[model samples]
Target chain A: MALLILPIIIPFATAILSLLFRRSAAAQRAISLLGATALLGAAIALLNVVWSDGIQATQMGDWPAPFGITLVADAFSAIMVTLAALTLLATVVYSLADIDVRREAFGYYPLLNVMVMGICGAFLTGDIFNLYVWFEVLLIASFVLMALDGDQAQMKGAIKYVVINLIASTLFLVAAGLLYGLAGTLNMADLAVKLRDVARPDLVATVAMLFLIVFGIKAAVFPLFFWLPDSYPTPPAAISAIFAGLLTKVGVYALIRVFTLIFVQDVAYTHTLILVIAGLTMVAGVLGALAQTEFRRVLSFLIVSQVGYAVMGLGLYTSGALAASVFYIIEDVVALQCLFLVSGVVYRLNRSENISVMGGIYRTYPGIALLFLIPALSLAGFPPLSGFFGKLALLQSGLAVEQYAIVATALVVAALTLFCIGRVWSDAFLKPSPAPGSAGVLVRSAALSSSRAQMIGMLIPVVVLVALVIGIGLLAEPVFGLATRAAEQLWSPSDYIQVVLGEAL
Target chain B: METILAFVVGGLFAAGLYMMMRRSIVKLIIGLALLSHGVNLLIFTAANLTRANPPIVPDGAKQPLPPVADPLPQALILTAIVISFAVLSFALVLLHRVYQAVGTDDIDRLKPVDE
Candidate 1:
């Protein structure tokens, strides 16, 4: 119970403290670090508790589940919470050296804390309406963070991000409202039980599809992804890393949660829809990446592409497939963050995010180049890395389902992703620096102390993440077992309802 | 009553979408405002329309909520309105800064460096 609530409470409390001590940079950093560390510890502890003793739930204010908000930490939520907390801690450290300290000291840390709170809350909540609340909390924080620098690019990005998210939030609200009207309940577990009793299958399917569209926009799937690449790159590197690591994954997590639990019987239509979208998302995302010459822009496109792998697993609709999707999501979040952090280093070294102007950086920053290589190759599904295992599992599962066309397209898209990332490597690191670059001067100066600090701070977490990915890859049996358990829990949903409502309907 | 409210909400949603697609920053703000209002109304309607009274307990009553409005949706709308207000203000400030920095409110003028 304590562990379930601490991840949210720690950050929120620290955010308030940060605001009160905004004028003191030292105090702000201390508070933020403390909060992040506490969150990480809490998340890990919760994971242990859940692993030892199944799923856990705590009703806020001691009210029963149906009438009061509940914070539930299942295997899936536990893992996501831990990942979000760890990424947040790393981003905080990265921001210490990278951010314009004097300008951002007051608001940035608080906003980041609030954002983490929202994310953790979103993962932990058991009420549908409360999930919407957490989404708004995170979205609002992201809007401020996106526009933090208040530059032209940031503003443009912020506008598009906000408008798209606002629309998505509205859609989410409408879906929740409709669901509540039909079921007369807003509690997720209760709704799952009552939804089974509802006679209108079409209405259930309609509301479920509406939810997919809303969450789809957030996850940057297929036609809904145009806003992501356009907006994400403009934020500062720390914010970008956190966003890359956590935001879309939350949407994906929600999609898995709702679809698997509430709409399990509609797998034929839903899975097919997901399959078609997944294929298109992968192909289109890589194509977008191929068309980009900018470092962050290409990374953004890859985010969309990687998301398709996760969606593909869900579409396959088997225990192995769902587990693979879970694995892919975790791998994608870690690998994407690593690549984005490396891109930040590239931008710092070259003073340009455009690949056309960046060259021979690997010679100057071998360590950073290597860090970038790990995630890049991993993302391309290279052997021995986490990304390879995730893709392998997804592809194998798709084949098992005899989704041969999807399997073939996924493989082709994987190749294209490899090509696109290789292009980024060549253009940005291997090739000679373009002579008389228009973006900026090509004066190869030693890295700034601040930049070096930022790089080291960022690299530590990437290293940790990569090592974890490798661990998961090596010990796939246990991890996949846990994921299978989670999938079973989701498929049945009886335990979830029993835990929340004290008895299954 | 529910049908009329739904039509009004739908019209507002269409209008908001149209305004959001425009190039002007001010129009975008207006669009968000309209969109939020529509969403609030939609939520209200989804709670099932009731006209008798607000959801409040009467003195010495066991369960005094017959034909009363759903207080949950109303509370949620209140929060949404507050959040949207904050977002709108922040957007206004950001737009002001963008205009000052770039000398234009036209999104087209803010094209990517590659473009």
Candidate 2:
């Protein structure tokens, strides 16, 4: 019970402390690091408890299950909490070097921790209405983070982001309200039980579609993703990396949770709709990536495409497919964070994000090039990397289900993803230096201004993340097994309901 | 009462959507505000309306009486109102800062970030 609440509490406390120490940059940094470390520890501990002890649930204020707000952790929620903590730690370390001092003093660390708290809250909350509250918590935090610099591009990007996201929030509120009207309860497990018995399954399905659209916007699936490429590249690389890594996946996580747990009555209609969206998302996102010439923009589009693979797993609606989706989400989060951080370093060197003007990174900083290469290749689903196993699992599950259409789309998208990454490689890394307007000769001179301490601060997180990715690849069996276990837990909602509401229900 | 509020909610939603589609940034903020208000009302009505009876347990009772109002929807609306208030205020400030920085209130005048 105590374990279930610690992940949310640790980050909430960290954010408060960081906010109080905002005037002192050094103190803020120290507090932020300590907080992230503690969060990761709490998350891992929680995961350990969930792994061995089945599922854990605790109601707020000692209130009983159906009427009170409950926090619950199954294998899936625990794993997500752990992954979020890991990403938070990496982003905090990277921010030490990547974020300017002015931004740090402007409450960056506090907002970051608060955002993580919101994310962990979203993962752990067993109440549907509480889930919406967490979404707003993270949404508001991210809104500030998006416009933290208040520059022209950031502001412009943030406006679109805020407007579209606000609309999604309102829709989510409506969905939750209507759901309450239907189920007479806000607890997710209770909703699952009641929704299954609701006489009008059609109304339940309509509400389910409302949820799909709401989370789909948050996930940036196809036809709903234009705002993503525009806004994601505008933030600082550390901010961008964390947002890219965890934000949409939360949307995906919610989709998986509600669909698997509460909205299973009409899977034939809803899951099929999701399958179509998944295929379209993959095709459209990769195509968008193929069209972009900017470094960060390409990465932004790739994020949209990668989200499709996770959604496809949910769409496949099998235990194996869901496990594959969970595995892919893990690999994608780490790789995307590393790739964005690499983009930050490269942008710092070249002073431009344009691929046409950027060159000589491979020759000048082979380590940086390798850092970029490993993740980029992994994202492209190359063999011997974690991405390969993630994709292979997804494809195997797809084939097993005879979902040849989406499987075929996944393959073509994979090939195109490789091509896009190659384009970035050749233009930004392998090509010889362009004329000395700014990129080539200036890179070496720019290196001098960035203190060695800053460089260490930057490279450490990148190295750690890359190493983690490679470790996952090498140890794919254990990691995949863990994901499979999570998928098994998700496949049986009865276990979730039984644990959360106890046998009384 | 539910039927009346349902139409009012639909009307508010329409007005909000229309305002949002306008090219002016201020209208966008107003639209956002209206939309949230509409959602609050939607929740209020959707939860099944009750009379003025309060959702309080009497001195000796363990739970509220059978005919008492359902307090859950009101609580949900209260929370939603606070959140939307925060978000709308932030959006307004953001719009103001955006105008100051970009020197435009016309949404189309702001250059696309992709450029």
Candidate 3:
């Protein structure tokens, strides 16, 4: 339990230190790196502890449950925190070379550290209202990061991003307020216990529905997802990669935690809505990807599509399905970050994100192309990749539930994902250079100069992430076992509530 | 009283949504402000609108008491108000920057090349 809290505390303290030493770029970088590395260590230690000791919980300030905020670390949150720590560490390394270190010294490292703290806190928090505070922490950090450059594209994207999220935050607050009003407590565990015994069950259902809306907007579900594609690609690659890899997953994690614990009975209605949304999200996202001619835009759209798979697993509501959803979330985050990193390298090489202006790069940068291809293929659900296993698990669960239409739609969408990625691969790597007339129109071709060090910095992380994806694919049984345990824990609700509110409650 | 508050907040919410859907950046900011107000009110109303006294205990009060406003909701709303103000100011600066860079407040005009 003590180890579990370190991920949140280390980043938070480092954020303050970084701000205090904001005038010195070197100090800021050192503090940020030290903080991130410490968090990585803490996450590993916590994972090891959980592996040995089952689950861990800590009551803040030594207060009993229903009165104090609690931090709980189970298998699901532990894995997520570990992944988030690793991703932030990689992004920090990438930012060292990518960002203007001196100009960004005051705000960049501090905000990033705070964002990581927010993500870790959200993952670990056991109280519903405290989760809202964590969400605000994440949001405020992200708002600053998105507008970091103050460029036209970033400013436009930031406006839409902030507005949409503010609305979602408002909805979340309303839902939390209602839940507290009804249950007479804001702790998630106590609410879960009280909710199960409530006489006015309809009110609980209504609040749950509102929560779904709030989290759905954050998670970028179908109708609520329009802002994502427009906004994500405009930011700097490191910021975009972290946002792509971790932010929405936090929302999905919240959905899984809340619905599975407190709103199980409403699943019949909610899961159906989720199923419909999943199918549409998958299809619409891939269609958007297909229509895109730019590398980053395509990846952004694909993120929408990939998130559908995680939601699909949850919507199916079987134990197998929920486990698969967890697996999908992990794989998607790793694979998506790899893709974005590779896209950054590609943009650096070609001087543009437009696929039309890129060709024959494989001749000069075969290693980078290979790195990009791994995640791209994995994303398409290719055999022997982590993405394949995630989708297969989802398909099996959907079939078991006799959701034939969803299964069929998923198959088609998977094929479309492959085709879209293949289009990118062919245009950006395999094809000959464009004709001279077309080549002349390309902007700043001089920017295509590639450095071995930059490629190494980018490619190493991509290769390691892809390798992990493949490893997870091969070791699906054990991974699935962990996810199954998590899903079972989610379904039971008793251990979580008891740990937070005491067994007597 | 609760139903009327809901109706008013819902109306504000709908107006905010409509304004947010517009392409004008200024309207979007106004919309967000309205929406936050509506949400704050919604959270306030969720606590059932207490009257007669503040949540603070009087000097002569005993261990237990009734007819007091829920302090939790008030605290949450206060925090939310601070957060929304920060976000609103940030949005205002961002909008100002966007206007200068793109020379237009229309979102449609500011579309990036890759978009």
Candidate 4:
């Protein structure tokens, strides 16, 4: 019980302490780092406990099952919690050097910690309404973080982000209300059990559609992804890295949770629709990435595109497919974040975000070029990398299910992703730097660091993440094994219901 | 009362969506506010309103008496109200900052981040 809530508590404590120490940048950074480390420790503990013990559930104030709010960690929830914690730690490490003092003084660390709390809480909660609240918690924190710098681009992007996400939250609230009205319960496990017996299948399907729309918007699927690319790249790279890494994945997680556990009755209709959306999202996202000349913008489009792969796993709705989705998310989170931080380094060095204006990175900074190449190739699904295994699992599962159309689309998108990545590499790294007085150079070159210490501080997270991605790739078998176990738990909703509701239901 | 409120809720939804469709940034925020109100009312209506007593336990009673209004939706609404209020205020403040930064109330005039 105590273990389940530690992830949330540690971050909240850290955020308050940091906010109190906001006047002193050093104190705030130290407090934030300590809080993040504590969070990672708590998350790993929860994961270990869940791995050894079947599933863990704790009711708030001992109110018991359906009557009280519950925090439950099944295999899937535990893995997500651990992944979120890991990403939070990496983002904090990167922010040490990437973030400016002005932003740091303006409560950046506090907001980041609070956002992590919301993320961990979202992953741990067993109640549907609690999940909605957690989403709002993270959304609010992200809104401030997105606009923390208060620049023109940031403000414009923030408005679009704020408005669209608010609309999605409102819709999510409506869906929660309607589900409660139908089932007379807010507890997700209990609702799942009760919804199975509800006589009005059509009404339930209507509510399911409402949920799909809500999560779809949140997940940045197909036509609903405009706000994502518009807003994500405008934030500082550390902020963008976390957002790119976790936010939409949370939406995908919610979609998977609800669809598998509660909305399984109409899989023929809903899952097929999801598969169609997945195909379009892949094609559209990669095409958008191919069109972009900006560094982070290309990566932003890839986030949208990569989500399609995860959603495709959900659409396939098999244990293998679900496991593939989980693997894809874990690998993509690590690789994409590494890419974003590398983009930050590149921007710092070249003093430009436009790939057309940036050049000679490979010639000038071989190590940075290598850092970019690893994740870039991984994201492009090259062999002997984490992404290759993720794509292989997804493709194999898609083939086993005989989803030929989506399978073909996935293959085509893979090729396009490679081309897009190759284009970025050629323009941003391989091309020789334009002559000193050339029109292509928008700004003079800026050194990544004036001192060795600052450079190492910035490089540590990027290097660690690169190693982690490589580790995930080399140890794909064990990681995929864990994912398969998580998928099994998701495949069998009865286990979740039993653990969450117990004898009370 | 439910019937009338249903129509009122529908009216709010329509008006909110209409307002949101306009190009003005302030109108969009107002529309968001209206939309949330509509959702709250919908929750209340969907939970089945009653003219019965409030859900308070009487002396020597362990649970709320039967023939009382459902209290859960009210609790849910209270939470919804707080969250939406916080979000709305933040949105308004964002609106203010955006206007100051961009020198316009027209959302259409705002450029894309890449631009």
Candidate 5:
């Protein structure tokens, strides 16, 4: 029980401490790093417990499941929490070098801790309403972080991001309310049980659709994702890294949870809708990236596209498909974080984010060039890297289910993704410096201003994350086994509910 | 009475959607407020209505009587309302920030950095 709650508590406590010490950058960084290390350790411990003991669960205040809030961790939630804690650890280290003292003084670490708490809470909560509250917590924190500098572009992005996200939240509230009206419980396990016997199946399905739309906005699916490209690129690279890496995947996680757990009665219609959305999301997102000249904007659109691969896994709805989705999320999160971190370094080197203006990073900083290629190639589904296996699993699942159209879309999108990523490689790395604004000369001069400490701070996280991406690719079987277990639990929730509420409670 | 309130909720939803589609940020916020209230009432009415007695167990009963309103949805709405209020206040402050930085409330004029 303590194990189940520690991931949430550690971050919450760290957030408070970080806030109290906000005025001193050194103290704040110390608290934040200590908090992140502890969180990662707690998450790993919790993962071990859940793996050995089976789904660990505890109800708050001794209240039973339907009447009281429960915190539960099956393999999937534990894995997500672990992923988040790992991301937080990497980000905090990166922030030490990347965040200006101004933003750090402006409550960055505290808000970051709050966001971490919110994310972990969302993953661990056994109640639907509780999940919504956690979503709001992380979101409000992200809002402040995105607009931290109050630059014109950041402000514009923050406005669209906030407004659209608020609508998504309101929709989630309405859906949760209506679901409660239709069924008598908010506990996910109880709802899964109650919803099976509900008299009105169609109404339940409509509520499911409402959930689909709500999470879809957050996942940045096609036709609903215009706000993402506009907003994501405007934040600082580290802030962008965290948002890009973790936030959208939470939406995907919720979609997988609700569809797999509560509203499985009409998978035929709903799953197909998801498949259709996944196809369009892939096509539109990659095509959108093709038009973007700025490095971050291209990456932003690429995030939308890659999200489709995971959603496609859910759309397929088989155990293999869901397992593939989980694996895909792990690879994508690390890759996206690395890509954004590299983008920041690229900005430091070239003095711009425009690919047209960037040249000769390969000649000047081969290490940074290699770092960029690791994620860029992984994101495009290159061979023997983490993304290759991630995409292979997804494609295999799609083929098994005969989702031919989406499978085709995935392939076409993959090729186009390479094309777009290739655009960056040629412009930023391989090409000689453009005649008038020679990037090599500019970078050499700026190296004086860009302190070596800052460079190490940025590069350390990239190295750690890239090593992870390679490790996941090399050690695919153990990770894949874990994902298989997670999918099985999602498919069959009896163990989950009984663990949470007890056998007879 | 339930039908009348349902219509009122529908009307608010319509107005909210209309306002949100406009170019100005302030109207967009007002629209959000209206949408939230509409959804809250929708929850209230959808959970089934009762006025005969409070949803409390009597002196010796283990459970409230069937005709008593379900207290769960009411509690859900209360939580929803508070969350929406918190978010609404945040959205308003964000709007003011955007306006200060961009010098415009119109959404169209705010696209200075985009392609």
Candidate 6:
């Protein structure tokens, strides 16, 4: 039980300590960094335990499965917990030099830790209501983080973010209520068995649609992603990096969990809709990126586009496809965060995020430029990076099923993604600095740090993440193997239920 | 009661949606508040309401008495109410901060500020 709840407890405890130390920014940072390290340690422990022990679950207060809240960490959930912790670690490391004193005093570190708690909790919970609770926890923390600085842009973005997510949360709440009423239970494993035996299967499908809309908004699928690009680009880059890396992926994780675990009865309708949305999300997000000149905005759009790949895996509903999606998310969480952090570095160096106005950064900081190139190319699905193998697996799986239209859409979007990435690279990193009196000309020289220590504080996390992006790519076989095993677990969810609800159920 | 509540919920949702689309930040917050109320009411209504006594176990009783107002929906709605309250307050405070910073409640004006 301690092993199961340790991920949540560590962060929640860390957050409380971080908030208490908010007066001294250095203390807060140190506390949070320690908390993040502990969080990572706990996640690794949970992962190890789950690996050797099969699914580790502890019913809260020992009330047994269907009655009490159950925290369960299977291979998939354990992987996500570990990923969330790692993202928290990177955000803590990167924020040291970036997050200003005022924002730090506003308890930014605590909010980030709390948000990580919510993410890991969402991943590990075996009860649907607990999932909703965790989502709200993360959403609330994200709202605070998104509006941390309370500047015009941050507030404006946060308003849209809050309102839209409020709508989605309301929808989620309604669905949860209705699902509970229908099945007389909100325990996910129990509901899995109970939903299968429900009298009105169509009602289950209706509730399933509600879930799609809810998770769709969170996942920022096609036609539901307006809030993401609007909100994501305005936050501080460390905040944006964490948001870009983890928030939507939590939604994606929820979609995968609910769709694969509980709502499989209507796969024909639900999965096909997911596939369609996946293709459109890819196209829409990349096209949106192409039209933008802002660094974080382009990255935000790519984040949306990449989610489509994960949703596409869910849409394919095959073990191979699902495994690919799992691998894709892990790859994305690492590299996308690196890119966002690199954008921060870009802005930090040149005092601008407008790629058109950004130049000579590459001239001054070759290391930073290299940091940008790795994730940028990886996100563009360049060969020998993590994204390449993930995309290849997704493409192979799609082709195996002969989903030509969606597959073709994926191919076109991939090409467009590369084009957009190239556009960013050429405009921001490669092109010569524009002359005075030129369009979007910038006079700001690269702020080669007066404080090299602060520069290293920010730069090292990006470098570490860049190394990770390369590491996952080079070690693809073992990673993909783990993903496949996780996928196999999803394919046979009965074992999950048996573990949670026991054999009789 | 359920029938009346359903219509009221729909009305609130529509009104909230309308207000949310307005260009004013204050209106946006109001809309969010309305939507919050609407959703709480929705949870109450969607779960098959009953007009029975409050669900409290009697002395020596193993479970709550039958038809005791289906306490689960009430419990769910209670939680929703608390969460929505927290969110609404935060939204309001955030809007207040925006107004103080930008000196405007108009989202159209705030639009350019984002860039």
Candidate 3: deviation at residue A391, Å? 1.4
> In model 4, how large is the Cα lDDT of residue B57?
87
On lDDT, the stronger of 5 and 6 is: 5
Once model 6 is optimally superposed onto the true structure by TM-score, how far is the C-alpha of residue A168 displaced, in angstroms? 1.1
Residues A193-310, candidate 5: write the lDDT tens digits: 8898889999999999999999999999978999999999887788999999999999999999999989999989999999899889999999999998888999999999999998
Sorted by TM-score (best first), the order is: 4, 2, 5, 6, 1, 3
Please give, for residues A396-480, the per-residue lDDT of candidate 4 as tens digits. 9999989999999999999999999889999999999866666756543244443567667878999999998889999999999
TM-score of each: 0.95, 0.97, 0.94, 0.98, 0.96, 0.96
Report the error of model 4 at residue A179, Å.
Answer: 0.9
Candidate 3 achieves a global lDDT of: 0.84
Q: Higher TM-score: candidate 2 or 3?
A: 2
Worst 10 residues of 3 chain A by lDDT: A439-448
Residue A432 C-alpha lDDT in model 3: 78
Candidate 2 interface RMSD to the true structure: 1.1
Q: Each candidate's DockQ score against the native complex?
A: 0.61, 0.80, 0.60, 0.79, 0.73, 0.62
lDDT of 1 at A278: 91
Q: Chain B TM-score for each model?
A: 0.90, 0.90, 0.88, 0.91, 0.88, 0.85
lDDT of each: 0.84, 0.91, 0.84, 0.90, 0.89, 0.87
Q: Model 3 compared with the native: what TM-score?
A: 0.94
Docking class of 6: medium
What lDDT tens digits, residue by residue, belong to model 6 across residues A1-505?
A: 6988889999999889877877888888888889899989989988888777788788899888888888888889989999998999999998998887788877888889888999999999998878888999999999999888766667778877887888899889878988987988899989999988789999999999999999999999998998898899888789999999999999999999999999999888889999999999999999999999888888999999999998999999999999999999999999999999988878776677788877776776777888999988888789999999999999999998889888888889889999998888888888776565666543333443426777888998999999999999999999998788789888789879989987447
Q: Name the candidate, 1 or 4, with the larger TM-score value.
A: 4
Better of 3 and 5 by DockQ: 5
DockQ, prediction 2:
0.80
Any runs in candidate 4 off by more than 4 Å, and if so which? A440-450, B113-115
Candidate 4 local Cα displacement, residue A297, angstroms? 0.4
Superposed by TM-score, candidate 2 places the C-alpha of residue A69 at a distance from the truth, in angstroms, of 0.5
The number of clashing residue pairs in model 3 is 0
User: For model 6 chain A, where is the 10-residue window of minimal lDDT?
Assistant: A441-450
Q: What local lDDT score does residue A132 receive in model 4, on the 0 to 100 scale? A: 96
Return the lDDT, model 4, position B6. Answer: 94
